[model samples]
Target: MSKLKLDLIKNSISYFREAVAYAQRDELDETRWKFAIINVVQAMELAFKEKLRRIHPALIYSSVDERTDTVSLKKALNRLVDPGIGGLVIAEKDPRKIETAVKLRNELTHFECEHEHEHMEAKFADIFSFMIFFYREHLGLETEEFIDYDEHQRIIGLVKARAELRTRARSYIKAENFIDVWICPSCDESTFVAQNGECCFCHHKEAVIECASCGQETLESNVIDTSNYLDWDYDEGRMVLMEDYGMEMTACQGCIETFKSKVEDMRQAQYYEYMEREAMSYSR
Candidate 1:
């Protein structure tokens, strides 16, 4: 990760720790608080030192439920903001940004080594948004007399700055389905493609898909771009993919460029969906 990206994660983690401490109870046994802090921090130590800025709040939180609720990051964050759950620390934001941040943060945090982190980073940076740490435990302030405009202004300013940075650096690419294995017809090596169904070197056809960039047709399961219709499946009550969108039997730079172009289109669709949800929230 770059120095700037790392700094953001570190700063957020530090703020998280301070918020927890600020909410500490003097009347209760300090041991409970101490252990709680240690346990959570230990899990996040690598995250802190490495400046873990993840798009998936669930992955970072990792407090899973085997038989209970499950949902998107936006939904989960909304749940945290319920008046009933005033004790959870969470970030509230424009639903679109939160959703975009989820993916970018995931790439920045978890997919760095494998998901073309270096190549895709320029675009990812623009999509990265700020998620402020708000404590569930309020500072003993009532609504009219408790909430201070100065504090709200400071936090909002920071959040806006972070979000703007993300927007500026973000790129739209739909490569989630690009991961696949295919045998090269020429080299006979197993190669992965992003968009279509083709071989890595000597592009050979496995499956065919549409090219988003140039409106060309191509193969599936090939080292291509992530642009086209995705095959989504339900597994264990979750959505999974059956096929990639772009790729062809023939491996070429032109094909790859085409795949990249399609990804941007898909990203726009994703943004729109997220914003729609936010609009609903306001109406409610």
Candidate 2:
């Protein structure tokens, strides 16, 4: 990494520590509270982009020629988790929560907002929890030194409280399907379960697809299913249609792209052959 990139990573961590301080402040003015939220969002954005830079610098930009000013928080988050768009699957948590924080930052930046301090305080706490989790898990940062000891315990308490409430609700619902039995593809543990469209552990998603060519199960987001079609068979120098063939080939996105390229080449060759035959007929 260049010095500039290294500085950015350091600066982001510094901003996160500052945000933690703001969250832990006994009394905070509205202006300072808003800044704290902004810093937290910025920290996550920078942190994710830094990780992306390590994996592939092009990932930090929306396009190959994207400028520094155009690097967006939404794009950064997508690069980290959006599978269809080639995300790295790091920071596999509820993206909506981060989006909500970003939305709050936007509103604060554009308008002079005044809200209950308690509401803002709760939001900050939640962001703090998310930040700690991301830093420790995704960024591989040791959060013990960065997080305030007392605040860390408070955040842990809040998470535990929420988990207990969710457990009680699950018991009332008595839904067996909601229970996790399969190992998560992302986390590689037994903590994989989905409710609605979201995964319980990583919040990644439940997208199962079986590749027709490879016969391997993969995420639906990573595969392409061509509309059902029939294949003709070549028999003794003659093309014959198989009326009873009814197999749909679903391929991985990579395989699909390769297959399409080959199909196009074959089509071009056939077109030239037909043109040659037509020319011969015209001469005859």
Candidate 3:
């Protein structure tokens, strides 16, 4: 192996070890979880790049021709899964799990966001399980090489707990017979019921309201309040008068374009009326 490939593999294993240490801490506080996620994701990305480099060193770069920067985690995964390219076959659900892990890593690294402790733990557990398999099967490492026997058992416990939680949540959702099941934004679990506006897995709640314009139900966050788009009268500290568009008007994501068009047409009409009045005054 080239020195570069050796370095990549070494760094990837090192990061994975550090991540496991953080994840298996007794306290497992927010700071520990944050670092655990960051390290594990870094490990995954390096491993991906290393695999790509093995296939073709040029494939590691974002553009093979330019060779300026390395490929992103997403890009690396795409290349690995491409039959004509890397020819690595990943599990069906692994892509989504990796995507969730990447999102959490980015959120922890670049921004501030709060996640429930259990939900975070479940996410970490899911990624950890997948990474272990990747290291053994893809990276060609023995189980004893990367993870200690005791630590491996603990990690298995974590994965099992997450699986049990999902099973229970799914059973409840099935019993309730919710028509519109969605993935929970909070937990990244497929137990959020649109009708209830709550996640069965994480129990996270969001407001679901009917769109004023389209009369279709959607998450309140997905709806644009037309009142905010209306012309404001700063001097009077109120919205400028319009005949039909009221403060209560709202448009869901789908109807926002139509709503904007209507608002624009109304503004144009008001401008035309003002111009006509100015013309009449000048004639006098």
Best by TM-score: 3
Best by lDDT: 3
User: How high a TM-score does candidate 2 get?
Assistant: 0.51
Worst 10 residues of 1 by lDDT: 127-136
In order, candidate lDDTs are 0.39, 0.64, 0.83
Per residue, candidate 2 scores C-alpha lDDT tens digits across 1-284 of 59857766787888887776665555535466777788888888888777777777776777757545535888777676766544545444456556666777888789987654533544565677777877787678786646767866865775566456446544543555554344444333344453333334334466665677566655666666654333467899986655312334567764766656555676677779999999999999
Pairwise lDDT winner, candidates 2 and 3: 3
Q: What is the C-alpha RMSD of each candidate to the true structure, in Å?
A: 19.8, 11.3, 6.9
Better of 1 and 3 by lDDT: 3
Could you give me the TM-score of model 1 versus the true structure? 0.22
Model 2 per-residue lDDT at 172:
40
Cα error, residue 77 of model 2, in Å, equals 0.8
TM-score, one value per model: 0.22, 0.51, 0.72
Clash count for candidate 2 is 0
Give candidate 3 misplaced runs (Cα > 4 Å): 209-284
lDDT, residue 212, model 1 = 45
